[model samples]
Target chain A: MPDGGDPTALGFRPALETVIPLARAGPIMLRVGVNGYGTIGKRVADAVRAQPDMEVAGVAKTRPNFEAERAVAKDFPLYAAVEERADQFGEAGIDLAGMVEELVETADVMVDATPSGIGAENKSLYEEHDTPALYQGGEDEDLVDTSFNARANYADAAGADHVRVVSCNTTGLSRLVAPLEEEYGIEKVRATLVRRGGDPAQSGRGPINDILPNPRTLPSHHGPDVKTIFPDLAIDTLGLKVPATLMHTHSINVTLDSDATADAVRDLLRDESRLFVIPERLDIDGAGALKEFALDAGRPRGDLWENCIWGESITVEDDDLYLFQAIHQESDVVPENVDAIRAVTGSADAAESVATTDDALDMGF
Target chain B: MPDGGDPTALGFRPALETVIPLARAGPIMLRVGVNGYGTIGKRVADAVRAQPDMEVAGVAKTRPNFEAERAVAKDFPLYAAVEERADQFGEAGIDLAGMVEELVETADVMVDATPSGIGAENKSLYEEHDTPALYQGGEDEDLVDTSFNARANYADAAGADHVRVVSCNTTGLSRLVAPLEEEYGIEKVRATLVRRGGDPAQSGRGPINDILPNPRTLPSHHGPDVKTIFPDLAIDTLGLKVPATLMHTHSINVTLDSDATADAVRDLLRDESRLFVIPERLDIDGAGALKEFALDAGRPRGDLWENCIWGESITVEDDDLYLFQAIHQESDVVPENVDAIRAVTGSADAAESVATTDDALDMGF
Candidate 1:
């Protein structure tokens, strides 16, 4: 009946305090594998490479295409996500380092960035290899032990066998909500997601010429996925797919527990590393300028790693807080994946982990 | 106290019911003088032209520019908004029909599309001519007797000497709020405006590389502007300017009087002539595609004249409703302007005015 200091009882490996320092002393790098190198996966692999303590073990792809060539050009060890497609790389004159299973076996953690639903299929394989894994928002909630947003619940993932990095919209909602939930206490939250029709490379998907209510179901699954993070939080989310490939924009309204000024809310969010309170002067007015700013600022693949919030847009009327922020669909999760690696491996606590990830990735704008 | 039959005592002209029908028989049209040939002004002028019962007496411009030429090409008798700038038209090889004052004197009603403060400045000119005036949202609240949103309060403007068509944002907000207020009742409202940095042609303005909290003030002026229409409503708004000229996107959350479903809200909005509940299938996702859809759909100036609400984005949880919709900053108000003409002149009731304006402009897309 001992409740304290039992690593086995707590269900985690030797405490991160013991394990992380040892890995640091030996100069041994954590091998991180990225599966499904598409919009999210490619960015995750690059972000994994950015961390000083971790190295990308390899990247896995279902087919030997442009992304496969990209994986080779980046010098990332390429693995076949589908065993049957192993020869596609060799025939395409690309050499393969191994299959995804081998990558899972060799790496310390595998980030499942495969297309939605495919991650669920790959989960058994990661489990067979006893590899702690990270899944993107596209996957089901059951596939992960917890839905992760570094700022919201970084520590929750520590020693967890599987973690799902919430979708871009949820990650965005979580970042904004966490501050309110912690600093002001959220009474209820409602957000409408103006989602991009598809990733920039997703040409085949869309209501290309119209605005459609994606999922046609009330309170799109995004709300429930967010619930996975804050189980008691009352949230309702509605999603719309627009013919946009750049980023998703979220209109958030949070009813706080107490009345707070826009300035107070701004100050609170400003203090968070992941929430970039866009200065009034920068005038990053919309997703277009945000992307351009990212590209011009020389962000890798024009990535906006932090939420681009309109500082002037952060306003409070009575007890309600309203603001708009853009979420870069392709790269916002990259930093989270890096932080998740530390979380799952007992490498760092929340503050130390987030700070390291933020500093290494140059997150706060 | 003989208020029963006296139109003046009732604060409206019986001319709409009595004189209008007689004037129609005599081939006389309602002369609408558009003061200001900018983004809103030009569109209003054209919309006035489109009305079967009205004609553009003239369109006033500050300077002889390309817009003047466009006005000339459209054969709208162009007037000089600034008397001193009249010769500029001749110098630019564009002919001027008259000065703004003459247009005001000749027209039965003036639709003032002048820049924000300029509308106030021209209010005296309109008063001097004893002409009933309809001002755009840009003017100060006190400059007009009431703020008009056809769907929300069309009847309020009937026989009113002066009315200010609410801003693009306000007009859009009123359309959505009106339905909820009527069917379910709105307890409170919170909205974030993702506004266009400038109209497509106003290249001079913007946070060209950043998103800015436009107005940087809490509960942006838009809320009070909406209050100008619904004086008793409890609403709060936050505003952001994005670097896009196509349209303004609104993220709205309404705490209703009673609980409702997304389907109920969608059905309610669908019944509105001014609100275009973008279907779940067309996949019209963002300003870019919405604009493209408008252009491809062969709308003049690629204007999406109705509020583009994402159908699937309509969701209600508890007594709250959330949705994202785009307001074509340039033209959503165009149909509203036409409806306001009918409203102010007592030409139509709320439903009739809205329907006539919608049919005349091919609104409700």
Candidate 2:
């Protein structure tokens, strides 16, 4: 009777308002098992920990490594990715909660942040457990029923068994394209991607002193990746790889179906929680500066989940829109992975999931 | 009469394919005085040395520096910029050929590459010697009646008393716009300028690890500067300063008056002598890589005088055209400065001047 919260039955006058989530009542928390435990995986696990309705079931790693030790240190109940390598963790002085299969069976949903092609191989394992899996952008489109971007097509992933979150560039494009398409119809999108050469720890990758065309062709793979979210939208993407390892800078131009002023578009973008419209007062210059700002702001690993859109660069002339935005490749998709968990599990709607993920992860500048 | 080729008088014994000039008939070599022996001035002096019709009368510097010594090593006479401080060169153990007044009187035209506002102060000196001067882009638009971009407004500077070569960004834009305006016609232009922090040696100028909006406003000064060359062309630019010290990258979207295919635009831009449409096979990534490539190719100072326009980025959707081009801030304007010399002196037509400067500097990729 006390748990039912029937104030009238308790013989006490009911309060003027009843808080739906009474102090005693908590939201349903889902156990999300993170696979791969690398850049995307570890960040997503931490994000899940921040969410009110999500908790890290555990993290699965291939073998005993620094990440596995860090996972153990976080008390995340580390699991061995390979059953045969389970003894390796013990030898490395790391404790394993169980095998990855057990984590998969226990988790409400599995986030596969494994390297690109490995996710495809992990599919059968996910199917064996009958557990829904959310794969990262590196995975092929055919591996999942739909490619996911929280802003562009989050609902397309709701209640879905297999979902693929697009790459950083695609995610950035989708986030910008969503509101524009919603507020004012979009005709075509053309983006020039100045991508960073590699992640901070990548040693073999390069352009160390150069800028190379990612594909040196028209309509790079990024445009098709974006199409996965908005199937009918026409987008042409050209990519260039630069020496910097900071972030990807995109020069975007969207031809609108109707006329809109720069101010109007700025307002529309500002309203979006994920689009961090950089104000004029803040002197964020490029990806390097953005990272400094994020680190100073005490964001986890200085991960920026928002599209750092230069507010001043958003200009409109007739039906054309132009803007420059920088996307922190390593972390922008982390929140999307978190939101994708809620999406695939049907735990929340797009707004609810995004809001929850944003609040928990401290999204936006 | 022997110096002047007359086919009528020599017809009786003239060969069927007689050349315009005999081997002994030398061309008119103009004495070009270079004022200010810094970055642009030194390059110009070397370019003048390479030109068959031009010679460096002397280079003037306020104080004896390494550049002055270097100039003397090249067998070019050096002059003191500050007449009163002429003894400074003697004290520095750098011998001067003459004073500024003598250099100005001896030269036919002066190329003023002095610090920004200093060019305005030197104008009276050129007038006192009844000499025309070609000023660098740093000088105000009002400092000269015409601002010169060889491809865009070479004729406008013809025989003018004073002329200013547009800035690096403006020159890059002008070169790209020239052909587009002639073939497709432009409705309007919107550009995003990702500028370098400063020259390689300017220790104090920096974003070092930040991306700062140069002005954090719409319609940056660059757009108006471009208009100085093409008064009626509409352009809006947003400026950003990054930690880089190599080049300025511009994201451009032009609303063309007519429709054109991407291939056709690429072909047009490729045909331009000064626009190096980066070939996909070259694999040059950005400014840093470009410098490395140029150094490998044995270019002087690894200077890229051409506008590095990405061929793959050229896209067309109905009436809108989009592309990204990088301007080498240090050396792209060097050729333009050379052309401005011909412009103010009326030494050659636009094509002739451009060809002469290009051949002299070994320009283009």
Candidate 3:
């Protein structure tokens, strides 16, 4: 298989080896378990199945709904809550596991896609079984060992057992902010989160006809949320909710300590690999087309996984900077979860894992 | 009465004075004419009446609608379209010595709060009468000699005959970006605009359940739109729209050419008069409370009118920065409008005008 060479030679920090020690470990037949079959869990399971070295050991759903039936059809093992012993799975002729714990303990890595605070509860379950866990962005920043972004903080997750993916808003902000922070020292980060009311699967979300102010709280701790990845970093966030669902958009302003020109800053951002700086001349309309572009790029699950940055939005005078970017929360974090699995299991080098994952990605047309 | 000193001594730039001369030409009984009385116009009429230095010259509406009747109730010298009855004003005990053309010519200044493109057409009428005109934010950038912001560019409008107020998005960006640019060298500006589907009066505003990308246009030209005030700015913008109505939120990212710390940058921003740095402990909730805060601050309109910046969002690691803020477009621009009027007409000293305008704002409870 494509072990690709010495894991240590993969340009990763020395600490990563403890997590995934490279012995002649015959391609570890890792079992992947997903606790929640919501938007994120579904994507995670699908992605895991596509990996050459991993398998969707099984997945657990809270209810035996349409999604559960669909999972059953895939011939992947399915488990339903004991209380919901509804024979939906049996009717679908699929063997059903008794409980979520079965799926959790059976897997080498468990990804908890439960709603925000619920991830903390599953964190304990994953720990009890000594099964490593990957978490979604919704969980609080304090819950995990570190927040992982394959490109930005792959090494940070090395030798760690638990990782939390920052919220969709934070993921988008971190990706854009990291590049700028890397190239230019960031002084202040001011952002307005134009959040979507509900996911396609969710119907109860929204302010409906009214333009409501989400939490007027400043620095939403989102800047700090990103900091879980880059500690000792100072950042703040302000948030707002709007009626939209496909993607989250962020307007950002940064004040640098020293004066730099706009062109110079743009040059720095362009150098980052995962960030695709949209040129000023593209007549691209919105996130939809960008999503299509990502899909066309053959990203698995139609994920426009990279941050789509607009070029003209770069402005610099004195030492300040401003720009805008769109972040697809669903897919951006998907790739990270894959990387985390490798980190916790000590299966591959961070760089090698990232490269392989990038290659494995179906950059779909 | 608080002219303070030579109107020219007030840091007023000569470039701005060439367009709108100081009304210091002695309490000039400037005749005001309103062609369309929609949301903005109605507000303008109220604002004009609130001014001790200016008086209602005359008003005109499309027809006898409830709005028109409301304007009439304000005791505004109302005139029907000269097209409907060329002699109606004369017959209704109103002076018609000069026709609409002559009326426009007679006014010292005309404020056009018509819909977007309509303001540009009225320009010639104002010009024909040797009167300067103030256009609303909806008009395109190229339609006027200058775009005005009392705090940032009032001096730029000193002598211009025609001035445009930038779009609400532009106005918000400019206010926030200007101070950052001034205190810290601005490197680049990126913004995602979560725009409202409609104003409060429009019923078909939004269902806002789907997050759609507004325009994938870069630099949203908002930074450039702001540059109309400070022409030398190097700014770019990317814009996205979310279904919202209360106010527009922007997520801005700025990259500095050189390295600076986040704390240093935050300190610089805190000093700017136009920006209201939300203290870390205020516990304010969202745009709604911020609006109320602005109103309680006695802002003329219940919008923050200033950028509601979160201090915590300011982060610095090496050279990157991040931040979030909310801009109340409706009322934020109002103060700028008042200042622009003074700037164009040379009616008040820049310092005095700023102070008075600031004091007049009803920030709200």
Q: How much DockQ does model 3 earn? A: 0.27
Q: Which candidate's lDDT is highest?
A: 2
What are the per-residue Cα lDDT tens digits for candidate 1 across A132-181? 88999988888778889888888889788789999888888888888789
DockQ of 2: 0.22
Worst 10 residues of 1 chain A by lDDT: A1-10
How displaced is residue A93 in candidate 2, in Å? Answer: 1.0
Please give the range of 10 consecutive residues that has the lowest summed lDDT in model 2 chain B. B12-21
Write model 3 residue lDDT over A212-277, tens digit each, in one string: 345543456576777777676666565666666667666666778677787887788787656667
Structural similarity of chain A in candidate 2, as TM-score: 0.91
Docking class of 1: incorrect
TM per candidate, chain B: 0.93, 0.91, 0.79
RMSD of each: 6.1, 8.5, 7.7
Per-residue lDDT tens digits for candidate 2, residues B1-365, read 01123334654212112211331255766678999999889988888888877788999999987888998889889999897899988998989898887888887678998999999999998776657788888999888868989999888876566789888899999999899999989988877777777887777886543445566555689989999988899887777666577788877778899889999999999999899998767766577777788889889888888999877778786787878788888888888877877666566778988898888777766
Using all chains and alpha carbons, the TM-scores for the candidates as numbered come to 0.79, 0.86, 0.73
Q: Which of candidates 1 and 2 reaches a greater TM-score?
A: 2
